[model samples]
Target: MNKHSITLSFEINEPQLLLRDAIKHYGISKKALTSIKYEGGTILVNGEEKTVRHILTVGDKVTIIFPEEKSSEGLIAEKGDFPILFEDEHILIFSKEAGLSTIPSREHPHGTVANFVAGYFAESGLSSTVHIVTRLDKDTSGVICVAKHRHAHHLLSEMQKAGTISREYEAIVHGFIQQDSFVIDAPIGRKDGSIIERLISQEGKYAKTSVQVLNRFHLQGEELTHVRLQLHTGRTHQIRVHMMSIGHPLIGDDLYGGSQKFISRQALHARELNLKHPFSGETLKIISPFPKDMKDIIPTKTTK
Candidate 1:
């Protein structure tokens, strides 16, 4: 009957403590909080579902849509493109480019892979069930897996949860790393008046990434290392955060470290993946070569 609702924004230097204070002040459940994660929700700093506990940093914006008395829900959408990598009776893997979201979120409503893929399926006269098992950030590129049916979706998702799926990434960081390989084992959570950007937290989720030096190149005489990263545990911004922690932040990761970029999106790609077939029990391994943008950064083997 009334359209009046509370819309308040708070800027906090210590977001975690302030969020704790806000919850107490407003007496709202943690779930009612939009996009705030506790090393927490799967939503990201840019407003995607990120699974990490986040403590607020200086000048973080916390917006509260306030409590709901009662509510109804609907799935409304707009459309875009869906690049098909491989598809079969039940499984579909796609080459999702930078600027395409793997699924739906409050922040990226229009330019998402899900909406695009669903539309693509319709044009082809397919069922268009389009069940996404995992998601990539709006600016990250490469392979994403989805299911065409609910049964298939649940099975593959379960396998992913059980550690049966292997995902690998490629990134160009802003420095030359000496180690042939390194592992980043960090627990992450929320920070700032925001809910999505993750920071180290003992109360955070388990995230591990292993990186191997792929090559080194010069940009304006400054050398930057391109790396192949493997994920042991996937968390919000795992590669971006891990690389930043090691002083080799991604070339175009403005949130982590923004420098040394040639592309409009983050210079990260999900280059390879391995998984077990949800229904057939067959092992599936998929690899994607560097997209033209990422490939351009490296010199030919003869040149090096």
Candidate 2:
């Protein structure tokens, strides 16, 4: 039993069920179950050790003790500034600002959301790896999630693959989209010569996006449309690519042929995230309002 082991307790409500059945009902992943079986983890009934095959009856108190993570390595915990939206022992959510990359890359070796989180964890005296569940592009400000440990990351990744994690983005595009709503079903692949740009192609991975226009405006003699988009598949630059394919690239998204006059970065913000808690099975909905730089694009009473 490590010092940071997680304990999950469940009260049996059914008449007769196996411990495994209860665990399944609780939405624990099979990979986690295997880890519990072999990684010094334990299952108990009331106070005694029990196996998954143990018969559970009404009011039986079942407990699972998960192994603790090993200490994180090779990370430089330099201090950074960001707002934490939600945090617990196993997870952290932050409102990352535009111009900040989610993780360190060759070009951005420091000053990323990961580095900021590393600094935060160091300040809090916690030893854990940076386990990001959702990633936002540099210049795309919004709500981002990170797991404090590897187990929570694994569970959240499973949820994402199952389409249980939902993300909504608000974007201001170049044109006034005539359709109130539409869906973009396209395959995306890296451009033939460019390493960073993604484009629609026949040989690419399948992707889908749903869009609904929120408001239309004529600002500074240019037409701009505020829209809400939902991603069915998480691909690199899915929204920008899809919108560009439809001749309405996001304002300030230079890579996608958008004009850079409105803002220095993409006129896109991750508006909301809906998902189940990795451990508690509770539904969590996190939101970030539209960034101030984008609000001027919206029509006011005078513009209307």
Candidate 3:
């Protein structure tokens, strides 16, 4: 097997179960099974090739070999130095910095996390393509998740839809928030005539963000509040829009009525992520420390 291919084996415990049912029970999608059948892959029972319809008795061993994957075209491999929080055969977690795009775009075609990951994969001789499961905004620094294969990507996507993936962010906003904790339940939609901006509207999709005030301090004669935010729904600019709607825009977030008095980018960092490992079914909690720009503004006496 190549570096990009995966082989999984299981001991059948139930009697007279179809191989197809067993595979499905193990979380292999029908599309993936179809690919294994048509593509260069194999399924074996007791060390012999077998069809999906074959009956499996207790003590039988089932093995599946997945086809090798290919990297996407036009995804150039570029070496870069970034912090890798955790990595395994199934997934890679990165502590990305600000001012770097997560993936290539029309405006930014290089120096992205995806390009760096592609370079790493090439150096490791793995043909798997870049599959980013969780992406952060260009100006937001935080923890990002990348899947190493298509099966892991599919499972992570499903986990996201089921609300099993959770993220927490720490942000410094423009004003002193009086509330200790609150939830901003609003609808977010694309702003009219602008593809990059989002606004809270009645006709928009449901979005909820819970906010907790961490500290209130004075910086250069301006009142600022450090807050921790938890996202209950994934929406474009949801945290920015929700914070702005509550009269406290993020510091340096000029697009959302904030001023860049002390910081260069939005003073937001993805602080924590909680999720289950797709392959091992174990809970994984990853964290990213505050970047230098944001950390410098906080008082030395205050704790994060």
Candidate 4:
């Protein structure tokens, strides 16, 4: 077995949030809480192991070890040189390109954003305690935040659980977005018997996305629509499943059978992020444009 070690001392008002966010920096595929219990590592809080439900005080020390597992790709580590969108004392945001998983997966162990980010940290001598504020699908590209320190990680994460951060995405779906603006308010959950699947449900977790039609046009015998999606509640693939439920899956997202006509990859991009700066207590908004393919599909003629 291989072993890796990390140590952090922080004034934490919350421990569970801190641990959960800390694990994200490792890019573990499982949920953070699950990672803590199952990652085969000893986690000591101020030199003592504690449960996730434990209440923590300030001045607690955290020590963790990342379990050694074979890389899925079985390839030599590659830097990948993923681009950065914004950075501050508390957070670092990346413009995660499409076709890249946010973190490592079994089949795609390498070439993930997390792996690249991890390599970057090792080279730059930065803290390894990256905290993911939110998650996007592998095919979805956009702004992703990583906390630089454990304290800020906990604070920013608590703010997220309290619904302080706002995120938006840009997508080009398969059909005309006839409505000027509409809402996809629904619940989402896992599909039975599938480890990598999602569906809409009545008893599932609640989620909402406000979709605004930027333009609509016809291209090569199929309806193409440009849209902006605002997430009110984050759920696993909520937007993708919701859009497919409405009969207009994204152009390339066959996972939801989005569009068989033109798009082959899920046509989604994390375009904007709004949140209060953890250290400054000031609101920060970051915006990014859609990829070249999406931008080219825009209806310059302007048909709503």
Please tell me which predicted candidate would have the highest lDDT against the true structure.
3
Worst 10 residues of 4 by lDDT: 67-76
Ordered from best to worst TM-score, the candidate numbers read 3, 2, 4, 1
**Candidate 1 accuracy as TM-score:** 0.70
Model 3 spans with C-alpha error above 4 angstroms: 302-304
Best by TM-score: 3
Rank the candidate models, highest lDDT first. Answer: 3, 2, 4, 1
List model 1 lDDT by residue over 108-202, tens digit each: 55557777766665555554356778778878888898776444565676677788889999998887888888888998767668776877677
Per-candidate TM-score against the hidden true structure: 0.70, 0.88, 0.96, 0.73
* lDDT scores of the candidates, listed in order: 0.68, 0.87, 0.91, 0.71
Q: Judging by TM-score, tell me the better candidate of 1 and 4.
A: 4
Q: For model 4, state the Cα shift of residue 132 in Å.
A: 2.2
Stronger candidate by lDDT (2 vs 4): 2
Residue 96's lDDT within candidate 2 is 85
* Cα RMSD of predicted structure 1: 16.7
Which TM-score value belongs to model 2? Answer: 0.88
CA deviation > 4 Å runs, candidate 4: 1-78
Give lDDT tens digits, candidate 3, residues 220-257. 88989999999988998999999999899999999999
- Candidate 4: clashing residue pairs, number: 2
lDDT string, candidate 4, 1-304, tens digits: 2323333334455534655554445333354345446856556777787664455555566565433322223323448776787886557887887788777767777787777766676566553543567777888888888876545566677777788888989888877867889998889988999888899988889989999998888887777888889988888888898898898888889888866455557889999999988656677888765788767666568677
